[model samples]
Target: MKVKSLFVLTAMIGAIAFHQTALAKERETGRSTGPVVYVIAQDKFYDSIVLADLPAKGRFQQLFPGEGPSGLATEYGPGDVGYLGGRWWVDGNENGEMDEEDAYFLCPLLGPGRDDI
Candidate 1:
């Protein structure tokens, strides 16, 4: 029984690792082409995490300096929390490093949010 349990656990872990590897490759290249691409929005509406089926048009945010392809930090909550699948970058002032001036954005906030649009 113990050996069988260990085998099942190992198989589960291997499957998860393979899924993550495929996802990382997809992120590096382009968005996932699967039929159902789910997206999680960090903003909480009425004390609930929002989840939606990712739209086809305007999916990822364009990365500066042309790093192939990239996306915005969508998992950031109201208080700026971090997560594994969230996007983090440093591309201000056209430099490759995050400095004091490059940390802030020109406008306080960007365009309309997902809920708004």
Candidate 2:
């Protein structure tokens, strides 16, 4: 009887340890929430844009050197945050960088080409 009780307790403790380990892994891999892209203009001709795979956890602000500040950094409630699957923007001068003269626009997250360009 004593051996049986000890075995049961050990098994219970092992199961609990395994459960906690799994929970930790889930937390480590958990995705954050928020806007997928946060864009900010550095100079009159340059823009800074950041892209993320999961939902954004922070605000997206755009500050055009000449145009001033634009966008809100506040979180819009729970699931309201948008996830960016992909993004496309103009690289002014065709240099693969967003410069002052380049036009910056959010491309469709998952679509084929923009007709307005």
Candidate 3:
């Protein structure tokens, strides 16, 4: 029984060491283990533009530069918030209006020099 227990413990330790070595080799080979996310945006002419292409695990800010209300941070509740008018929605089904298939979209709050159309 003692010899059996020792063999099992040795096997477990070897398995763990092998897994760690494999992970280190993968990292040294420059292999990414996370998904890549592409952030798309629309220009004034309604043209689709690739704003950012980064890893999904990377930190990202929702609001773009020069956006949001004055004297306030980029974070804000969506929809009509006092002076800031208009609402944001993701047309998931490619429809013009929000529906069951659509979702609430978090975008930069419009401020001075910004237009919501």
Clash pairs for candidate 2: 33-56, 34-55, 34-56, 45-99, 45-100, 46-100
Q: What is the C-alpha lDDT of each candidate?
A: 0.27, 0.25, 0.27
Assess candidate 2 and give its TM-score to the true structure: 0.20
2 or 3, which is superior by lDDT? 3
Query: Across residues 47-116, which tens digit of lDDT does each residue of candidate 1 receive?
Result: 1111222221222221222221111223343333332221222234456554332222111122122231
TM-score of each: 0.20, 0.20, 0.22
lDDT of 3 by residue, 1-117 (tens): 334333433443344344422111233335322111111231111101122222223223332222222211223322323312212332334555434443332223222221221
| Highest TM-score scorer | 3
Q: How far is candidate 1 from the true structure (C-alpha RMSD, Å)?
A: 18.1
Regions of model 1 farther than 4 Å from truth:
1-40, 43-75, 83-90, 101-114
Local error of candidate 2 at 71, Å? 31
List where candidate 2 sits over 4 angstroms from the true fold.
1-86, 111-117
How would you encode candidate 2's per-residue C-alpha lDDT over 8-70 as one tens digit per residue?
334433443444221112223242221122222111111112232212223222212112121
| Sort by TM-score, top down from the best | 3, 1, 2
